[model samples]
Target: MQRDQGVPQPRLLHIEADYSPAVSKTEPWVDLRSIRIDEYLQARSLAVKTQKAYRQDLQHFLRWTDKAWSAVTARQIAQFKTHLVRKEEGQRVLSDATVKRILGTMKAFYGWLWRCGYVDRDPTIEVQLPKLAEPEADNLSDEQVEKILAAVAGTKLCDRNLALFAVLQHGIRAEAATLLNVGDFDGQRLWVRQDKGGSKGVVPLDEEGVQKIQAYLGWRMSQGEVLLPESPLFVSASRRNRGARIGYDTIDKLVCQLRDITGIDFHAHQFRHTYATNLVLDGMNPYHVMTLTRHKSVQSFRRYTKAADQQAAEAAFYETKRRKRKTEPGSEQ
Candidate 1:
């Protein structure tokens, strides 16, 4: 297969000492896998975490194959699927969903190789992967959101923590939130310079979220923290990583802290789910919700709608009972 004309070729990155296209394909296949994976990844604008995940998944496939690339066929792909699901003593039995993801990675890998003219046939093409169940978005109610906000309202680092929560509440992922810069906030909105799924744009902040972020920046200035365009929006206050760009670990730790204090069984991602759910419940257009959530695919946006539909059905049932009780004989109008 000749390289597609419109496909934007990505610059080579992370080349290893042992990686050379000139190296014979008959050698250990790791070199070939790494080179091809790098090329495959660089061709598209995937998130850092996404790219890393692809690398890991593809590497696992390469190791499992344990043979020359050209020799793999649909039968080997099926065998690999069995290897993932078997409950043998040493074999790590994966859930159907996980196995499905791995198989997806395999299809994507071979598909790319075929498109890039690295492979003649895609062994994963005919092999079937399990159909996944509809994903349910977590429900973090409005009251819970208020409780989370109020929990930090009196703290000394109130501005800082509130700013972080504001960003999360507005639907920014923890990793992307951590990657924000001081100048990313424009008083009215946040510029999500980097986003998952290659969908980067400005995420409009609610008035309260904007105020919290502005106050946080103001508080930093009061503490003699020099604010610069390039400064990390959130800095670590921990002794080890103090004044450095906040890490995703810190985001997790903060959620853990809040979970302990408020007795809320939630994690960082629940905020995003809540954000999307709230939008859906409020009758926002799906396209508008997708824009707000920065979802590039309708499939991704549909998860919240599924949960919202269930919630609406339950709400209507309760509402019907309430109306019937109100109109009962001798009941108050």
Candidate 2:
């Protein structure tokens, strides 16, 4: 009786395999404590949310199959995907996109196992990922962006807000913003060390961006606060967490605060989308823009190009028909 190893199992749910689970209760032969999940997560340098999602998705699969990671087969992985897609009452199910994500995670899991010598073969190779619709790129307009900026101007954290948003509008993510340090900025390049989905890189800053940051730092120093190279770029000014590094929740609250003040509802991530969309609108090659956006995958990058394409086509058609007339939505009737 060989002990199942590789990914550590939590507890026995129901063995979906033809054979029964190993009779050994202690499972002394099994390397349960040595589960490579933490190691794999750290190696990937995944974002906190992504790490959580990967853990959850993997756990769900393990709970369903109730088999050792070594025993999972390509066929069984496919079966699990099928189980996710076919919605049944009182049963675990997922959307097509979600099913695709789960299978992709599984593929990564098994690929790691094979590379690390834990498995002779990758079980996820033959398991097909479910097709999902191309994700639509969402963005705010120039005017809406300006409105948000204005809304943040009157706030007590105006200097910080201006500098933070200046960076965000250039393609940095919210999570990456929190990870930024004073040393990461050198007046020209903003080095984002911790990007979402692990896409870390240096983002170039324009003259205005440099000024915004300089003003923020100047303001920090003006208030008798010492700015160090190791200091967090953004710190909370609230009574409870003053002088402390801001968290992801703080970013979310900032978005809500801006939306409420400006009466323009929007998401924090839209800053990156807006940056990408505007570049595509300016006739940048989709492939080239990824270098600026630091996108790791072309599939996700397609949304920017597609959205820009649609908008350009519509504008061109309307301009031709109206002879420089702007068409409003639902005015065709």
lDDT of each: 0.85, 0.85
Q: Please, what are the lDDT tens digits per residue for candidate 2 over residues 1-333? A: 776887686896885666756676663464452377667787786778899999887876867766777887878887887777786786646777888888888889889988988789888898778777888888998899988998888887899999999988998988889989999999898988788776778889989899999999999899999988899999999899999999889889888888778988899899999999888888888887898899988888988998778888998987798853446565654
lDDT of 2: 0.85
TM-score of each: 0.80, 0.79
Worst 10 residues of 2 by lDDT: 25-34
Task: List runs of model 1 lying over 4 Å from the truth.
Answer: 1-31, 89-92, 154-156, 310-333
**Over the full model, what C-alpha lDDT does candidate 1 score relative to the true structure?**
0.85
- RMSD (CA, Å), candidate 2 to true, equals 15.0
